[model samples]
Target: MLFPYLLKVSLLLGVLTLGYRWMVQFETYSKFNRLLLWLNVLAAWSLPLIPLPNWGPTRIQAEFHQSIPKIAQAAPAVKHKIAAYNPAPTVVSHQRLSSLNQKLKSLHVMQWLLVVYISGVLVLASHFFYQVGGLVWVLLRSPKEKSDRRVVFVRNLRSNSPYSFFQWIIVNPEKHQPGELQHIIAHETEHALQWHSLDLLLAELQRIVLWFNPFAWFHQKLVQANLEYLADRAVLDGGFERKQYQYSLLNAILCTTEVPLTTSFAQSLLKNRIKMMNKKPSHYLAWGKYALLLAVLYVSSAFVAPYTLTLVKLPPSILRPALKTLATNDKVNFKEVSSKILSLGPSKAESLIEELKKKTPETTKAIQPSRSKWVIKKNDALFWVISPLATLDDINEIRNEVKSFDAELNINSIEYDPLQSFIARITVHVNVKSGSSSTAKEGTDRYSPMKGESGYLTKSGSLGTGSVPNELEKQLQMDYEKALALSKKNEPYYFETRLMEKITALGSSSSHAFDKNTLNGAAAESAFRYDGVGKSTDNFLKLEPEHRNSELYLNSKPATFTELNSLSFDLVRSIKIIRDARGKKYMIVYTN
Candidate 1:
């Protein structure tokens, strides 16, 4: 949110700064300068109201809902088990749980607050856009005659010259000036052709969206000045002399007629036009420099923007040294400290002393240190495994191979339920000894008879009946068949080799050493089935290839744990490899 807002501000500021520099260098003004200035101001004021989606709040909502199941499953199971054994736990343990609950509640409140803020900002932005749109529409519809022939006043003040939108021009046909009418027509035509009215309206709109930003106002001014420049170029291209053009511009500025929005000849700021006429065209290199400056400005704005507000709390132990250093400084007034200490009664003084002692170095050493280590007391540990087959029967041979390790290995659980029309997931839980557990990380190297020798080779292809036309369906079927054949020939071999490498690596890295002193009952709690993803059985089923065969899968395939194991050597080891800041790594082993 901050990034987008800053970008808008920088863009507006850059435009204004560049425009002012150009104006100073040119020593002249365009006909619509005053109107452009006013429009720019309006745009700046309305900028905050411009409608923009609040992606932050939306993302928070999604993440919260996704994590809810995991939290509910983990929290309740531990709470129940603890309560069953003892109605109330120690004060320390109870306090920790209470703190966790408070944190969760705070997170929920923050999520809602974000949602409300986003909603309000969006509503305000929409209203601002609507107001600007209305103003532009009214201006565009105003009554103005294009070419009026009256019987009265006809004065030839100057020759044909270019004028920006809403700039008034003096025309006299009675004097019979050469090409005077043609030049006037051409100048006005240029304004209409360039849609200068719409440009002004947009500039004004931008100003309103960023009214608080001075840069927004500047940007509008720059755009108006450019409009004038473009119009001048058009007039020059139409074969008007620079001297004659200057005279015409002067005459137009001298005329004091306010033209309607519908009228092409609307004279605005005459002084600025006179100044602009005397200036030379800008160089191309200036634009390149401006572009570079814009890039730097954007990067700086992004870097300086405030993002997260989560600050790490410094423990009192870390602050004690700093406090002691400050107290020792001669500049620190002893009188203030003496007065404050005297103000406290004997009882209060004792309480303060006690509080300080609790935060003191000796007290910190006596208190229990953070549990940063775990020990493998038992050889048996739980491990979650996923397989491509729907049932244990399909991988009975592979399971036997895994059990051949010297330690006792037990199958904790297995599931082969269809989640969707054709999709299904096969989840298996196994308990293995700490030493044997290392094999879980090793990539699978099993070769079944059903495995495709030619990888993902396909025998047939067809365009299933749907909304597609016959010709399009035929073309799609041909493409599908080609893809299937390629996959059949190449995919199986690639997956087999990759899986073998990963499994072997994991088996080699198995660790048996564990720190028993740091182990906590809470840390050993098992996560629920739906804790990670969700309780959407259909979603799980649809993810499997067997289930997907029933439907025309449109979305791209997601990489599963199996695929990740094959690709990343480090990831093949385990789901998590716990390590402390001191670089000591610990492997967790679960017992069923």
Candidate 2:
């Protein structure tokens, strides 16, 4: 999960970074470009927090950018752990044991990767703090000059290069030309006025967090580079001759020292600086390109954004995937028999119930509980949140309240039916502040109805009074199906329709389901938007110019261009475009 989050940060950085590199690199709008750079960093991290209508490209890479950005950015890989809740019974299958072993091994590897990443962060954080401490010491110990800016003369300082930290401008009078000293002060002052040090500090912190990512460092480079351009333009605009300022920059070039949190005057970005200074001013209309960047960002937000993701953690008993055939196992133990019976699946459970009827003639027919307490919802309204009230008339009186918050359904109905092998228990997972957990169904009258835990589930609605179930798709399966069958074609089932209208809320979600948002988010998207954002990888093949030159991939791995001919864009989760060293491009497609 941490991996995917950071990967999103990295991918977003790469995309906006490339957008800047590809569309507009050099122009005279240094101040505006500097702001864009700042915003790019903010957007990279924050965009992942905001969900859009849907996802955009899985990947948009530049040949020259760092490689790690593509890794987790577009690839949705997670380390999984097997059910460690209950120990395996005496007679476990060899294949099941092997799968558990593999998963445990992967969990261990993921733990180590996390440890290594944390260690890197700690080390870099210490270094970053040390740099900040050094700058702070110099600011405090050095002599101050009376000026509008907080100017500090670093007496007998080792590094001759003048730098600015927050509002303090550090310079040594002996190291500069008498006239050039003013220019240097002016340059450093620009940094102070604009609070450029804050940007460097943010970039440094991101570096500490994303130490393994080369693009993070490059992202910092861009931030610092843009700040320098901003300062250079400021100096030239304020009556300083361009030629004289260029000479001053060249003259100040010495054995420059690096300060992580401070903005230095003699930056080594000379070539780019010269190009930027001479570059023509861009037309105001060029701002339109930024809209394309916004659109691209909006697209990326759909997938990586924390769109209402919820984890439906069914009990491990139901998760065994019918590994062993019911008829094949001869020496089945009591626990194995119960697990097999419970895991028979929804459709198979119905058949198993029928078979039970012939075997036990004493069994009573299943009695339907009072419809009052039952959380019956129509099939089409699967995505809607229903009120907990008994009828539509009660919900209509408080329409405003029902529209905003999910009504908590205190479902306590239970019936004893010997013929009902499945109890049809509904346990909703929510975070109610005052509620206590109780067993959904005890082993009351054997026939072991599938066991599962019900936790509190609500979409930004706190149901302090009772358990609230947001998604009743799986739990209310039988009820929903029956309601659908009862309804007239193209008409709502009157009984359940009037029953669920008040509860239908949260059409789009951004819920956090414990530890598996990506899995849950993807599943929810697949369920709600049957056709998710069509990936653009295969679509690139339709372009004559691109098909002739670009490389292709399916699911992140290299593939021949011909594969795109058979590719179904409808099935794709996302599409990525990568450019290699020779300017050749890569089009990759991902499917669920």
Candidate 3:
């Protein structure tokens, strides 16, 4: 983020510099040049500082994907492949987690760079203020004399230098002959009347803030040179001899001593000043060159301007309807239910689910057979007898209604019970509120095949319904409970206690919770941004660019953590917690 901001600043600087160069090349009017330079300099420093809309160009949101795993069962004669999809855990030992946290606390190269840059700015700013104070002191000590009604000159100063400090023309009479003093007064007066001192002050402030930028120094020199050119033109325009003025300037270079906040009459770079005085005057057409400044500013504005995006999220409540629908079906398949819910989006799915839930009088109970199946049939081949008194035509209508709810339900056979007249052996299921109101009891034995020596027997000779012993079942239950507890302990949320406590203390809900000591970079970021908790950390990184820090490790190898979207969440396990030293709310994620 810092890099991008700096790059934009640099581009603005380049564009303005190019404009200045173009104006200088054509010898455009000095006053217009001064205006262009000042405007561009201020624009370059300030455009990036202006807070643009952060939501537009920089907003990032987590994507939602269906979590249900797909299952496809094949027939007996065909080969079948079953793959169970699970979110695998990443394990990090206790010792390594401690080491990672310690490593995270160490200062990075960018941090050191900021420290050094800030130190330079402080030093330069102090010196600029000191120079301003020195100019004030010189004004207090020097004797003031009225040269004319329009000019006020300060004479007999300890420093023999001639300079202007904000409407006051300060010069030593003893150092210059009467003729040379006349030219010097004229030069210094041009600086005072035109308010060149203010330009110098602005340049000084820019230097202090951008002390590390060589372009800033170059820009200051350009402004200073332009001021001198304007002053030289004034003296020449006042009818001073070019040769005599040139000699005075050359003579005063050695004795010239001016502070940052003042404009001096004589200084180095006499060649550029003399060259400008000798050059032919620029044409009226060249004045049109100032138009480029406007273009440059426009470009800079477009470059720094931000864009916006509205984040979208689906609520978890929408899944309840689909879950209920799956519960009512004989074959409970999560993959199909989840797909249906997601297809309708969160709000629509939720509304539809609610309507479906309202139609059902009570929750559907799971099937608990009195005796297990002797030979289990495929889920598609099996059917449940919801109504025994309904006719064939009624069965067909009911089947269509159930199929409308979920196309996966297949009803192929219908038969009448041999002993009970008008009783049917057909399976036709529909919603209770769909006008046809024959009710079936919950947990009824819908799948029962008679055991005989010669009928529907497997190759094993007898149809065997397997059962676990009572003690073995109890042991399996205990193992399952222990495994669940251990898995919970390893989740990213498990180690977020201390961080969450600190966040709560700050009285901010925007803070992200990550198990830095256990979860890896990708997993930590996912937890921080989209953990189904109250607040999300999606926009956290954009809040504070300089303080946004993350360290990622893939298979124990160090990796770059740029954006959360680019990361693979499954590979992350352990993360290191890092707190921002700056007093703002910022979080750092480290993953392994």
Best by lDDT: 2
In model 3, the runs with Cα more than 4 Å from the true position are 1-7, 49-105, 108-110, 147-151, 308-592
- Put the candidates in TM-score order, highest first: 2, 3, 1
lDDT of 2 at 241: 84
**Tens-digit lDDT string for candidate 1 (67-91):** 4544775784444344445566555
Q: State the lDDT at 87 in candidate 1.
A: 62
TM for every model, in the order presented, reads: 0.31, 0.48, 0.43
Candidate 2 per-residue lDDT, tens place, 464-524, comes to 1122232332444444344333222212112222222322342321211111223234463
Candidate number that wins on TM-score, 1 or 2:
2
- Between prediction 2 and prediction 3, the one with superior lDDT is 2
Superposed by TM-score, candidate 3 places the C-alpha of residue 302 at a distance from the truth, in angstroms, of 3.0
Report the Cα lDDT for residue 277, model 3.
Answer: 88
Per-residue lDDT of model 3, residues 1-592, tens digit only = 4655666666777778777876653383787778878888778867765533322222111011111111122324577797987888877779988798777678697887788878998999888778778877877887888765366787755766788887888888889888888888889888888889888878777777667777778778888888888889988999999999999988888788765667887768789889998888888777566666675566555455321111112212222344655554867555455455434533354355445534533322422221222211221111222233334564455344334324222333444322222332332222221111111121112121111110111111111011222222344345334434443343333234434556557564444344433233445455444432111243222212332344332322444434433444443333334333333433333344
Return model 1's CA RMSD, one decimal.
27.7
Candidate 2 deviant stretches above 4 angstroms:
53-107, 150-156, 307-592
Model 3, residue 506: distance off in Å is 42
